[model samples]
Target: MAAPDKAQQLEEAAKAAEHAAQTAEAAAANASGNAEAATAAAEHARMIADQLAVIASASPISDFVFLLTIFMLAIFVGYYVVWSVTPALHTPLMAVTNAISSVVIVGALIALGADLSQSANSFAPKLFGFLAVALASVNIFGGFLVTQRMLAMYKKKER
Candidate 1:
């Protein structure tokens, strides 16, 4: 076979190099496009996850309203039941009520005594505690006086 000419061999080598460079550029562009698409997909997934987290952490207003409704209903029921008591039994009932209120006074005293150092700085809780104690004390004394008056009325008259 005849030896290939030097000029022809050089021309073929140049064409092969150009072809390789073109193939490499096309592959790089395809890889860049794939990377961009993957990045967009990851960002979308992250956004969805963040939205789900916010939904999970949020409290519903309707639930709070339902609890408030139940509490108000209980208060109304208690008021009606107390008002239905007979006058003759009122004194005894008041005594029992005063006894229950004593527990409230104790709780209030505890709240007032806790963290004495902070009492001077934060006054609202202490003030409420003081009010609770005063009100409970009044109820206890008033209940005892009413009971004494009712028992006196039932005393037998001397001949």
Candidate 2:
């Protein structure tokens, strides 16, 4: 009876060892799959980095061409938009443009106030800033005057 009990205990221990070995094998297989996926992701990131590097090194002429294309598109769009508006909406549009000109004035003032002690080539910034401020001021004042005149036309005349 004692020998039979000892044999049963040995058999249970062996089965448990076998199950543990199988679990370890499965875990190792999962780790290997994860490593392969990580390698693939790293390769994809490297490819994108290479593409961005090429674009960054593009020539100045290409950059200029791209900007010029955008500028031309803007001009055409602006012309169409202005022409498509009804005459009655022009006053509101002028007021909006005046607000935009005020933003330009703010930018000009920032440029004008840049520290001159940092660089000897400060004159160009000052000159351009002054011109921008002057032009934007004129545009704002003119737009307001036009808007005021347009609004006046709609008022009831005095007897």
Candidate 3:
């Protein structure tokens, strides 16, 4: 009877060991699957990063092209607008343009007054601001002269 009880205990221990081994095998399989998924996810992230890097490298040229297109369109539009105005409205238009030049002068003055110590590239702004002030000043003075001449043409001649 004692020998039979010992054999039964050994059999139960063997069964428990077998169950533990099976559980460990299943856990190992799940871990390997997770590792594969992580590797695929990392590869996908790397591919996206490469695509973004390519776009970033090409961004400046695209931005320049876009701005050039808008500038060309503005030139065409401004030409058409100026050509379409009636002759009688020319004096008023000149006055408006002079006003716009004054606004430009104000902006240029602000730019000129900006602090140069904060930036290494500040000279360009100052130079362009000076040019803008000079050009706008010319535009304002010329526009007023043209307006005066146009108004004079409309005045009654004294006998």
Global lDDT of each candidate: 0.73, 0.78, 0.80
lDDT of 2: 0.78
Best by TM-score: 3
Error of 3 at 119 (Å): 1.4
Looking at model 2, the pairs that clash are none
Q: lDDT tens digits, residues 1-159, model 2? A: 999999999999999999999988876676556556655555655565555547657845476655565566556555655655556567978998999999999999999999987888989998999999999999999998999999999999999
User: Candidate 1 at residue 7, lDDT?
Assistant: 75
Error of 1 at 31 (Å): 89
Of models 1 and 3, which has the larger lDDT?
3
RMSD in order of candidates = 36.5, 25.7, 32.6
Give lDDT tens digits, candidate 3, residues 1-159. Answer: 999999999999999999999988876676566556656655655565566557757776475665565566556555655665556557988999999999999999999999998898999999999999999999999999999999999999999
- Candidate 3 runs further than 4 Å off: 1-62
Question: How much does candidate 3 score in TM-score?
Answer: 0.60
- Give the alpha carbon lDDT tens digit for every residue of 21-116 in model 1: 998887667656655665665565556555654655585546566456545655655565455554555676788888988999999999888786
